[model samples]
Target: MSAPSSRSPVIDTVKGLACMAIVWHHLAFYGPMSDIAQPLAPGLMAFLYDYARMAVQVFLVVGGYLAAASLAPAGTARFAHAGSAIGKRFVRLMVPCAVALVFTVVVSALVRTWMNHPSVPEAPTLAQLVANALMLQDLLGEDALSAGVWYVAIDFQLFSLSVLAWAWVRALPGRWPQQQRAALARGLIVAGAAASLWFFNRVAGLDMWALYFLGAYGLGMLAYWAVQSSRPHGWLAAIVLLGGVALALDFRGRIAVALVAALGLALAQRMQQTHSAGRTLPGWADGLARVGQMSYSVFLVHFGACLLVNAVVGTLWPASAPINALGMVLAFALSLVAGRWMYLRVEQHVPSWATALRWQAGLVGTGLLVALLSNGV
Candidate 1:
């Protein structure tokens, strides 16, 4: 029988772990909590403040890996309707993100009444909301309504770019043989990734563009193909060499971390293939995988959760480390609770609106929920 098409617990564990760190990073890096907590353990807080964001590379790699697995599973460029693919991706990301944005805007307004930390976002202008809705906030120079939102736009750009890249490979002049086509496709992906890492990634002017982050994203794609290949080690080594060369040219700690994560994923896939004799997995692994599944929701909602908790702590005990630490714990716990609710209610339950009326109804429902949560009503 063919292998079961289930998610790997290892991947989910990585994602879940990253989600926790990201939540911690946000709380430790922003607000009066950071100022208070830093005095207790400056080194730890400093690490979280400076390097925890790099955990995003895990998601980047995972995104590319999944994109490749879905779009071009057999190691070749293959997409029939690029626009349709783009549209599906857009809706999948936007539905929940739009709801999260609305929630952020409302929560931000309420939190501003309690405290005025720099972490507290201002009331969004019409332009700001529209720009973020279009995922063009970075390009339009409008501030993001929530933390880590730029990644949502970047993920879309990377997916579109990757699809286009694969389509270009498939459309090359000659009708090459199967093996030749696969080789060509892999080569193009590598070239694009290398360009991003060695050139585009280094250019400060290009930071807002998807190309700048494609290097890490491409590594994830390469890793998926590598694990799926007959010779996993060879492909894994190639991925390592690509990352090594990029680092040798210009050392980037973020890229280095991404390289390691990509390697870990590749190795994990190989191990699963070799040792997964049974369908069942460890309980903790399964639990973490659920978190991985909810990671997008957590990323979208955690900032608002943080703001609410921080507002409470700030209002009651602005400079107290103990209270701030408690706030951080509550923020983390509440984010997971809220994120799970969001995943269930908004992300997955997003309506398959057959008409504009249905879509409007969904929006109205989301608005009502946000309003009720925002007010003590």
Candidate 2:
């Protein structure tokens, strides 16, 4: 999700919990550690493997909520410069992502020497490196260097699509009234979401594009509008009906998860608005909210951190279930530490085109160098 300029405790709590679920899902899905440790708790491991990835739907909903809040809080485009807004969003997402990719490339190379496992990626080609830097790895059919990187590309595309939609409505001819323009923009989003849930999402081949994921994202956008509307009940009911029909059509578990998350977020915002008189979160919630603030960093760097832990722990105790389980915990802790470092160093800075380009170039350059040295060139 794109980082939000302001914070909501409920949003942060949802994001923080979902971020943890995603990290554990990856650990269970890709591991020598999880493989060996499965015997200790097969049910838990299986649940994590199969169901925890639904946390991604939470992110999609949250991203849409934030996008709506930032771009059109009052149901209309607030800014005139769509290009500059889109460019800024790209730089903000890619600068941290480029740093994470470079780290993962180096980690994969090191793990490849001694750990002969499927999780370790091979040396990159120049084309692959370039494609990844440009966020075209999935579109071009190049393997990603790290887990969850595809989300970054999808996020960029979704934000761009929303920007273009709002801009198009604003540029419509013949001096339409503000209310009419806003209605047109909202209608376009609703149409896109309906198409996605009813058709595009079921195809499975269009996962790389924004259309496939727009249902969840658009629900989030509608949730934001629901919070702003005077008749919140009607808007909330519309959200449920949209997602309910999608589920009735195909019964996707992920869409169900998104629907629940979107409803929860809308309800939470409604409560916060009504009860805004000197309320403060407890200590635990404040801590979780802090984690939510740094979630993008955690999501970016956790894969590499987990890979290194997997290599070390697998080498040390390949068969001890207890030890491997402990290693999983250790990896999760280190991932948080690495994520905090990334957040403070990269994501917090004011992103610029120059800074984004430098990081992108560094990722490609380092990947090419690693490939050359691995091949004895």
Candidate 3:
């Protein structure tokens, strides 16, 4: 959609809510605190553990929507320098990611001594550290240094894939009509999404690649175009059909979540377009939007924050369900605080190659140092 440069309250609100879900999902999924607290609210813990992870589907769709908005609002490549754009995107994602990983590695090391829980990642090898810094840990068969870090890698891959697709369309020979060019570009996205939904996504082994998640991501791109089109209903219907057929063929709850999120985004944007005057949101919504704006920071740092809280709480009150429940709450609060700090100090700043490299080096260096110190001790 040809959205205004101004931020969308709807998108931000969705992100904020999804971010909260992910944080809570991790809290419930990774234990000690959740283990101790589950007796108090078994059903609630079970639901969070099982269902809340689907919130990531919302992020995938939103990521696609934003990628389309930035890369090709009119269905053609907007930027001339594909390589430069890809590089910039990498730096933008990894600078903050590296910083967060360093924190996570350090926290994991500190927690390893006293907390022999499965949630604490073991000491990193140099290879593992380097792989993680390069966002290749999954591909290299190394354990993730933190929860949800895989999303950061997948995000970069999806963005790069989208950029390359648009760049390919833009490079086609002959004076093709702009409409035809746009159609070709969109056709590629549709085909990729279909391949993902019908094939790659079904194969668990392919989860490390962008193709496996393109179904959700492509729905987001389509949703953006649908919102921009005069015949939005028709485009929206196509989205529904695509997702419906995929689900009918093979029912995946994550895919359904993605489909719903994409449709919700389209409908919300349409409503905003129809009522342009009432743009101001209520205070709570405004707060949510703020959280959404910084959601990436929260996502990056929360595992370490929650880990620290878990270690402390489990040590002091291992048998107290109420105390452990309160510890969960405290962990959530600390995650928010840590997220705000990261957003303000790191994410909000414009990223650079130097900054990204320095942070990456720091992550690897710190990880090696931790390993060495642990060995000496």
Candidate 4:
């Protein structure tokens, strides 16, 4: 195995934890809000779990950070090349998203057909499927295949915004001053958050499709690239952490989220300072790293597993809070297994094969294989 770096392994661990928390959240899929509102199992477990959605801010923040760092090298003159950075990023997220979209179309349609809801509200199809396959559902304001899929749009838009922000900083290096780009990020995050709060409170419910999520992502990216790096002067990190929690508790969502994202990225930077590659056998972390590698697939495939499992179990056995919890546990276990399988078989193996296949039969064979797999299967 390649020696694990300071950032990647820790980020992988965080991803694993985030994905697991997401699974727990989705367990409430089939039930009413009252089901969750009436719980306090395992002491404060319910409260902790309920609030864990807050951690997704870390994922968005870290994602932005990594993407920004990748774009901006620590060199002399000129900003990083934008075209190359964006192209590489597009492939990294897009390939798996495409695979997930195709997989969702095939499976959701089958499930809907199986549940005898062939004409039900949530039934899947080829054209609607194509739109999702292209990640344009959110663009067109159409429905989403899954709840979490909207994040794809958020990630894409934030990516463009991050690039623009980077360019803006490069252009106005004077206004940004020395290494205090954190101020710029802080300013953008506050403005975006304020606007988002206004939009959410005054206009309607949580609009993930609106630019708020994108703004959060942009703020996250800005922090990732501009600030939230480098060791603090002193206990500034501790101060930030405390202040973040205080503001969040005071019912400030945007600032709290930005702070949390900053905290996670900053924490990662701090950890990197103390990082050592004790390249012994990887422990519980190895399993978690594998989960991180497959996190995209897990995030994609998990909801299907949960929906199918719940549909089957709820039909055979009456559904309740306890039943929902048990089903969620089972869904997580099954999703992990399935996700790992996809990572190893489809994702990991295909890249090495792509090169060889390109050299041999070239574009003709590649197109044929793509056509066969996408349409034939």
Candidate with the greatest TM-score versus the true structure? 2
- TM-score of the candidate numbered 1? 0.90
Clash pairs detected, candidate 3? 1-224
| Rank list by TM-score | 2, 3, 1, 4
The clash count of every prediction, one per candidate, is 0, 0, 1, 1
Instruction: Tell me the alpha-carbon RMSD of every candidate.
Output: 4.2, 1.0, 1.9, 7.1
After the best TM-score superposition of candidate 4, give how far the Cα of residue 39 lies from its true spot, in angstroms. 8.4
Q: In model 1, where do residues sit more than 4 Å from their true spots? A: 1-6, 277-283, 350-377
Residue 138 in candidate 4 has what lDDT?
64
lDDT digits (tens) for residues 1-377 of candidate 3: 11124368899889989999999999999989999999999999999999999999999999999999899999999987899989988998998899999999999889888988988888999989999999999989998899998999999999999999999989999999999999999999998998898889999999999999999999999999999999898779878988998999999999999999999999999898899757698999988887888899999999999999999999999899999999999999999999999988988788789999999999999999999988885
List, residue by residue over 125-210, the lDDT tens digit for candidate 4. 44444555456676666677665677766666666665666556556646555456645544554455445533442343445444
Q: Is candidate 1 or candidate 2 better by TM-score?
A: 2
Measured on C-alpha atoms, candidate 1 has an lDDT of: 0.80
Stretches > 4 Å off in candidate 4: 1-7, 31-52, 73-81, 114-121, 125-127, 168-206, 209-211, 214-231, 234-250, 253-258, 279-282, 319-325, 346-377
lDDT of 2: 0.91
Off by over 4 Å in 2: none
TM-score for each of the candidates:
0.90, 0.98, 0.97, 0.68
Report lDDT (CA) for all predictions. 0.80, 0.91, 0.92, 0.53
Residue by residue across 1-377, what tens digits does model 2's lDDT show? 65656688889988889999999999999889999999999999999999999999999999999999999887789877999989988999999999999999999989888898898889999888888898899999998889999999999999999999998888878888888888889888888988888889998999999999999999999999999999888778878888989999999999999999999999998899899746988899887787888999999999999999999999889989999999999999999999999999999888899999999999999999999888989
